[model samples]
Target: MDLDGLDALLAKLDRMDREIEGDVGTIVKNNTIEMTQKVVKNAEFTQGYQTGYTKRNIETKIVSNLVGKTISKSEHSGYLEFGTRFMDAQPFIFPGFYNQKKQFLDDLNRLVK
Candidate 1:
């Protein structure tokens, strides 16, 4: 291809990259949420903890050109994670990210390509 053609191709790639990045973030967020829900379902829920689980939700926010997603339980999520007086720690957050890394990259690759 000529230089002009090459330049046009590069410009198109850059544009596609921007679009793919934004889309990939959403895809990652949705998939990660599934993992979070599974972990929550499998978690050992006592009396109070069970109530807390009902408040679980996911949120997506934008910062400049980036999209950020959060899987939130409640204000007491930290207490459940670290354990309080009579309860043991039951982590449900970090594990949500376990399957997301590879899936995110895969989505980026598929969308960008």
Candidate 2:
């Protein structure tokens, strides 16, 4: 090809490259924005749920322990039970609270990646 024809072809190729780069950059920017919004929303929800659950659990345990202590002092003072049963009952009462919190954290980690 002649010099002018070759130059024109090169110019066209450069334009195409720039357009592709611009399109790719836009797509990446949009995806980043969407992912950021989702992460923020998930974090807010997880924090709210965790805070409420923790507060309630603490309150319930405090009340239950107080009542149990009072009962033991009054009637069942002689035979007091302590150890695994009392400790194990907490996880059971809360269901999947601990596991769910762990899973939420794991999901947040994945989102960061």
RMSD of each: 4.1, 19.1
Q: What is the lDDT of candidate 2?
A: 0.36
Please name the candidate that would achieve the greatest lDDT relative to the true structure.
1
Model 1 bad stretches (over 4 Å) = 39-47, 52-66, 109-113
Candidate 2, pairs of clashing residues:
none
Poorest 10 consecutive residues of model 1 by lDDT?
54-63
Q: What is candidate 2's lDDT per residue for 4-109, written digit by digit as tens?
A: 6888899999998777656544444443334433333333333223444322222111122112101112121121122144332222212223334455455545
Model 2: worst 10 consecutive residues (lDDT sum): 65-74
Question: TM-scores of all models?
Answer: 0.57, 0.38
* Deviating ranges (above 4 Å) for candidate 2: 1-4, 48-113
TM-score of 2: 0.38
- The sequence of per-residue lDDT tens digits that candidate 1 reaches over residues 1-113 is 54668888999999988878678767766665565555565343533355555344434334334454554546666776578888887765555566556766777787766
